[model samples]
Target: MARLRRFLDRIEPQFQKGGPYEKYFALYEMVDTFIYSPADVTRGSPHVRDAIDLKRVMSYVVVATFPVLLLMLWNTGFQANNAISQMGMTGLDGWRNWVMSTLGIAHDPNSVFANMFYGLLYFLPMYITTLVAGGIFEVIFAAVRNHEVNEGFLVSSMLYTLTLPPSTPLWMVALGIIFGVVLGKEVFGGTGKNFLNPALTGRAFLYFAYPAAMSGDAVWTAVDGYTGATPLALAASGGIDAVKEAGYSWSQTFLGVMPGSLGETSTLAILIGAAFLIYTRVANFRIILGVFLGMVATSLLFNLIGSDTNPMFSVPWYWHLTMGGLAFGMVFMATDPVSAAMTNKGRWIYGALIGFMAVMIRVVNPAFPEGIMLAILFGNIFAPLIDYFVVQANIKRRMKRS
Candidate 1:
């Protein structure tokens, strides 16, 4: 550790102002700060200092995602292996199968090692594509704008990769991330200044632009020609009965053993991550509580107004909590500090809006079964207005007291 620090210190002058590599200072600083905390400090008065910096905050989020990441790998492989077994095939027809065969790993769903390893093959490629494509944009923007490269992309890339279907094309992965970083964020002034979540922005672009690839029964499982509807999609079509007929129970959905997007499937895993974030104060608990209450209230209302036509109207609030990306988005996306409402009271409104809209879209709109992505984006758009009203109300109350 000492040797590495000394090495960085020795080469620091070469990247400083007026040096030959001065233009690449952003690149240098990115690597340096990533490995060690910055040496620079404020010397002036009236500056409040804290032990936690941006890097630590971002790193904590990445760390919190560990439980979700593990489940994503295990569940992805389990689904694929289980599908292949049902199809009566020995293995897939590509390199993945070849590697598994050489490694003596069978297509057995019960084998924990086999499931995780097989899932890694699917996950690693997409993650690498996201990192390379998104990192290039981050570096380019930092170099052009003459600012230190922010650590936010680390979180964005991981979150975006988790949202994608395992079989998503490598090219589409690159294109989606590029669109996300450039338009969703950079166009609005990057990272903390952006009004939208960059990860969701790119995902939304792909959802609209390439609808066939993004959704439907074919995309969830990695095996080609295997068609399986997510529990939420099943509920959308045949109500809770359809999901049960397809062999998905509330417990299965809750544990995330069923088919869906990689990280979004497991409510248990998402909650684990949420607990850590809330404990560390990285995520706002009010927003989480508000989202939960709003979802329960709306879902219960729909249940009361039972629809003879739409089965989705019968889904209970607890089922809604376990299904799809509701839990995942409530914990991660709605709590984004920059995009969420700033005022304390506004956080409640913002979260409720997301929760309400998510259920509304899932039940009322037959076209789209899952609604968290659109709901969070909607909340992000209205966050500023929500905050504005909150501020005005507070001012009026204070003035009356005076």
Candidate 2:
């Protein structure tokens, strides 16, 4: 502690007199030494240290994302059961919906459990394939780089799986994760060094690679025969007229009674996960709050602008947050510390821009109803630039004051 203080004391003058800058500089120095302790072991530092580890960082992320995983299990199961009922396959020659329904607490063979279990059965293979493939890549990278396998991918894999539709093929999942791990994380120098979240990279890869599995009428539902369109897709396809006739209720949407990705359908579950994340301090509330504000504001502006073709433009700005992956993405992906803007000031802009871009892309690009994935990936790439400009602007202001 004394050594760190002495080191900071030496460099403090270069930053400024006693102020937040000095304080932040000191904090950065402390974290730099502590977080970068591995470098000290190799580089022979002044031998100052503190208590912190990669496990602690990764634990926070796991803890934060736990709610999301639980919600995914329930929602996926629920959707699968509902789809089965619609297809009248709840009772088959060699049916298993009875057991599924009993366990998940949904009575009708076509109830929540039937759906949840069906979706889970289908999605689990894809999820496992992705993790295994991505894990192999991670291990190879770690072996070649001679660094410990970082904890970053643990949460990334989970997030990636959660974002996927239950029906995505296992092979496609494996390929996507491979692309994500190799291109997104490994190529960028592994783990914390990556610019974009690796999981999103995987999702993006699959989206581009297998647009059929990634989207369209079949991917959202668990049933073999029935055509299940995602709420966003339904809205996009038929606009307000299609959705109004379908009578997509708010309750159904909140309870995950809709066709969509594994975890994104349940606003209720996502909110629960959001609360858990915020409570654990794994995510920044300010960034989340600011991003919500930006999304709401931007959505309102677009809604007010009055699109002539899409009467659903009047579907209330609040719905944007609940629909699609906006809730999950904001709570988990956009707030990733490594990829996010470093400066506090930059976070506001970074988050806001992500929110804006997400909504804009979703509305403007009919082909893609879920835009948060690409938007956050874009934000991650531009984070450093945002921070750089923010710092440069601060420097200029300080110099001008002088």
Candidate 3:
């Protein structure tokens, strides 16, 4: 560690102002701070201090995502392996198959190692594409603007990758992330200045623009031609009965053994990540609680007004909690520090809005079955206003007291 620090100190001058590599200072600082805390620190009085910094906060979030990432790999592989076996295909036809064969790993859904490795083949490509494509833009913007590269994108890229279906094309992955970083965030002045979540922005773009690849049954399972409706989709079509008839139980979806996006399928895994984030204070509990309560309230209301025509109207609140991306979005997306409500009271309102909108969209809209992504994005748009009103209300109360 000492040797590395010394090495960095020695080379720091080369990347300083007026140096030959000055233009690349942002890249250098990114690597340096990523490995070690910044060398600069406040030395004056009246200073506020805390152990947690931006890099540490972002790092904790990445760590918290491990549970979801693990499930994403296992569930994705399990679904693909199960699909291939059901179809009785001899073998997959691509580099993935070649690698699996070379590694002597079988396409057995029951084999944990097989499932994990197979899923890794799919996840790695998408993740790499997101990181590289989004990273290039982050660097370009930082260099052009003469600012230090922020670590926010680390979380953004990971969340974006998790939001995607396993079979999403590499080209689309690159394009989505590029659009997200450029338009969703950079155009609004990047990171903290952006009102909308960059990840969801990119996802929404893909959802609307390239609907064929982003949604529908064929995209969930990694198999070439397999078509399996997500539990939410099944519920939307024929209600709980259709979901059960399709061999999807609430337990299966909750445990994340269903066909859906890589990370959104598993409520259990998302909860685990949520717990870690809450414990670390990386995520706000108020937002999570508000979202849960709002979802329950809305879902129960729908249940009371049961629609004979739409089965989704009958889905219980608990089921809604475990369905689609609700759990994932509630835990991670809605609690985004920059994009979520800043005031304590406003956080609840923002969260409730998301939860309410998510259920409303899922039940009322025939076009989109999963609604959390859109709901969070919608909440992001109104977060500032929610905070503003909260602040104004507090000011009025204080003024009245005075």
| RMSD after CA superposition, every candidate | 6.0, 10.4, 6.0
Task: State the TM-score for model 1.
Answer: 0.89
Residue pairs of candidate 2 with colliding backbone atoms: 76-116, 77-115, 77-116, 78-116, 80-115, 81-114, 81-115
Q: How many angstroms is residue 11 displaced in model 2 relative to the true structure, after the best TM-score fit?
A: 43
Stretches of candidate 2 exceeding 4 Å from the true structure: 1-52, 90-116
lDDT of each: 0.90, 0.73, 0.90
Cα RMSD of predicted structure 1: 6.0
Residue pairs in collision within model 1: none
Report residue 376 deviation for candidate 3 (angstroms): 0.9
**What tens-digit string does per-residue lDDT give for candidate 3 at 1-402?**
999999999999999999999999999998888667676622221101223467757888898899999999999999999999999999568999999999899999999999999999999999999999999999999899876787789999999999999999999999999999999988877767788889999999999999999989999999998999998888999999988999988899899999999889889989999999999788999999989999999999999999989899999998898879999999989988878898889989999999999999999998998999999989988988998899999999999999
Counting only residues 3 or more apart in sequence or on different chains, how many pairs clash (N, Cα, C under 3 Å) in candidate 3?
0
Model 1, stretches more than 4 Å misplaced? 1-52
